[model samples]
Target: MSISFAFLLKHIRPFGTSGYDTFCSVDLANFLIGNLGLTLGDIRVLYTAWRGVALSDAQSAAIIDCAKDVANARWGQLQQTTGSTVMFLSGIQLQDLSNASLGQSFTWRPASKIAVAVRIDGGHGGHHARWDVEGFSGNTDSQGAICHFSDLV
Candidate 1:
């Protein structure tokens, strides 16, 4: 089975605290599943690594970039069959909130598009995610925030 970007966006909820890796790992795992031709088992392992640990700090770019670079060196960086994956900004930075409309404390999906909101300091933000799932307790949702077209990179 193939999990498309649309599917992930329509199903996965935002992690509390707007951590970049939370979103990045999920994306990188999906991206690698498509790019590297990983097995279903490999994909399962990849997803498990999501939100498993915190790799944040002042120098997280280097940290995340290194993980993205080095994980390709082998196929089992995480476990016997699971290779760790990392996410990097594709250099398509934009602060467009023209489509975002999520509220401050809900997991319900809105008809409008989703924006990942990044904090000016601490943690990570994309589009405008603060109000997306900040107070959401559910692990997943029947529907999720839509990934903005600008954020399709």
Candidate 2:
């Protein structure tokens, strides 16, 4: 059986060169229960990111700490939902973007772009579902990036 899920990222900051870093967290409970019609207990939470510029040892630690805090906040929000289970998933992938101009503010350039792909599993629901979601990508400024969901098999 396949299940359809919908979620959105709340606050994600642009990459910068001043050794500045930002972290964001999103709540999945509302998306699961309100949109997908599933209880929090029946769902799982998985967080992933493509590693960007690594400034220094302290910067790395701060980034990790921020990510954890965001995750926990999202989990807590999910718990407020009745009969929900926040199952954290593993296997996070980090992409290095030290050479790319990530968080910098400058004119558009193709070389400094990044892409993120989100896979959503939609079980045999026997119908097409409507998805209205927002996300970020390398071409966000010009082309605009989106979170995609498709069914395989």
Candidate 2: segments with Cα more than 4 A from true spot: 1-11, 17-59, 79-110, 113-153
Q: Please report how far candidate 1 places residue 114 from its true position, in Å.
A: 20
How much does candidate 1 score in TM-score? 0.25
lDDT of each: 0.33, 0.28
Alpha-carbon RMSD, candidate 2: 15.3
Give, for candidate 2, the lowest lDDT window spanning 10 residues. 85-94
Per-residue lDDT tens digits for candidate 1, residues 3-122, read 235423322322323443344555556666787778678877644453332233323343343343333343333322222322222112111121334432224233333332222211
Range of the 10 consecutive residues with the lowest summed lDDT in candidate 1: 89-98
lDDT of 2 by residue, 1-153 (tens): 111222223222223323122221223446646775766555433222322422323234334443344444545565422111111111121112212343322222233232211121223212221112222232122222212212211
Q: lDDT value for candidate 1?
A: 0.33
